[model samples]
Target: MTIFASYSIKGGVGKTALAVNLAYALREDGHRTLLIDLDPQCAAAYYFRIKPAAKFKFKEGPKLAGRLRRNIRESDYPGLDVLPSNMAYRNFDIMLDRLKKSRKQLRSILAPLAEEYDSVVLDCPPNLTLLSENIFRVADHLLVPVIPTPLSERTLEQLYQFFKEKKLPPNRIRPFFSMAQKSNRLHREFMAQLRLDYPVFLDTVIPHSVHIERMGQRRRPALDYAPGLAATQAYRKLCLEILKG
Candidate 1:
């Protein structure tokens, strides 16, 4: 299986939304997908309508955690499965800070399952913490969602510069525009800059709309719920691009 992470350094950039829907879209195309909600908030589980109870709490006791981990490992969905997140995952950084192999934890957990599915989509947190670092280490591909704004662009530049200075590989760094508004002059200007400065940026761009924001409320991706919408079509095309890559 190919592991792809939907990530952003800034929150509210539509990263998780894209991750959730894109995984569904890939499944619709017949790829077995595992959507890994790596965000500590567990919003991905909420989106999938999974309720956590004391009996199955992922953080409670050793027996329950081990059982759930086995379940996650052996899970079989029709076309997809979810390795859901828990709120206690917020403590992952603090818990693993002194551990030498923290960055490899994610990779170790996933290596055996690498061939079990066609794709594993990780919905990542908004920070470059240890979790994000491990994500970087394991991901075969990274989809970075960049809002068409100065602040967002600055964050993207910072990310690129970070890896460049640290001498990390840049081959998998692909960027696509998000929350774009073609009617706005600023948005248009940024697109112009993106096309000029970043010639390889994906041509497919996600537009700003209530339809996209309503995704979180509906707890489903537009591709699943409103595939006729422009944003859904854009994300579908983005998924196609990812597959082609």
Candidate 2:
């Protein structure tokens, strides 16, 4: 199975939205998709109208996989399932820190899931901790949502530098413009400059739109609630670009 992680060192750059919509798009493309919310905020799970259970106990390897399987909830969409996040996940770094081969432990825990899912989309928490290291080691592709702004650009550079220092393969990072305002000159300039700087930036740009903001109210993916909208179409194109790669 292909593991896709929606991640960024900076938050509020449309990362959760990317994960939620990409998972739905993958499901629509005939893949059995599992959206795993690693963020303690649980926004992706909430978007799908799924609630986490009262408690979740952390474990290692097989036990961890079994716990996740038990927690999986079927979404309203046919081929999509969600593993909602727990508040306990806020301590994920501490949990991984106690494990042997900690950086590789997440891959081991998620390995068994390949039998059940064609694609696994992770809604990752924004940070650079031990858990983030584990995610870096586990995910096949790191889909970073970069807003066309100075802070976002700085964070993206920081992410790349982290990968370089850790000797991780930087090729796994696929960044794209998120919440872009076409009429804003700064947005256009940064988008062009970033694309030139980072050749791996995906061609699709998810424009700033009211439809994406309405996801919280609608409690579903924009692809589901506003399929014909430009932002929705951009997500579909982004999904196709990632798949094609």
Candidate 3:
């Protein structure tokens, strides 16, 4: 299975949107996609219209981990398998610390599904922590959503440093642009700079649009709700680029 994680060290740069749309695009291609919602905000679930039942809540104290510990069955998510999260997930750090185990809990949890699904797309919270570490440990390809800006570009530097300090390999990371404004000169400049400098960055760019923003409010991926739209087509191309690698 190709385990692709969509994450960004910096928030508010459209990471979740790109992840959601790309997962939808993969599902449309007849691939059995497994999307794990790792963010404490639980936004991915909302986007998929998956309601949180009482069983989805934290059965144990101080942890927001999913209760479905088995290999994610097809029925876990009616359309596509989703390991949903709850608001209490913000407490997972302390809970993980209390266990005093390797921070690779997320990897061990997802290991069983490696045999079941074709692609495992994890929507991680935007930052480095125990959860991020475990996600990286298990990820085959890391999908970073970078905007066209200096600060966003700088976050890429910090991500490399974080791994360097921790003695982790950096080759698995793959970056792409989300909400790109092609009309802007700076966007063009950053794209050229990063593409020349970072060979791992993908080619397909997800352009900025009102349709993409409103997609979240409508509670569905733009590709699913409007596949004929320009944004959807761009996302599909991005999926092809991902599969190419």
Pick the TM-score winner.
2
For each candidate, the alpha-carbon lDDT, in order, equals 0.76, 0.91, 0.75
Question: Which ten-residue region of model 2 has the weakest summed lDDT?
Answer: 53-62
Clashes of each: 0, 0, 0
| CA shift of 237, model 1, Å | 0.3
Superior by lDDT: candidate 1 or candidate 3: 1
Candidate topping lDDT: 2
Question: Residue by residue across 12-52, what tens digits does model 2's lDDT show?
Answer: 98999999999999999999999999998999999999997
Runs of candidate 3 exceeding 4 Å displacement: 53-79
How far is 16's C-alpha from truth in model 1 (Å)?
1.0
Ranking by TM-score: 2, 1, 3
Which stretch of 10 consecutive residues in model 3 shows the poorest summed lDDT? Answer: 69-78
Tens digit of lDDT per residue, candidate 3, span 113-161? Answer: 7676787788888888776887778888888988978887789988888
Clashes of 3: 0
Task: Give the C-alpha miss distance for residue 185 in model 1, angstroms.
Answer: 1.0
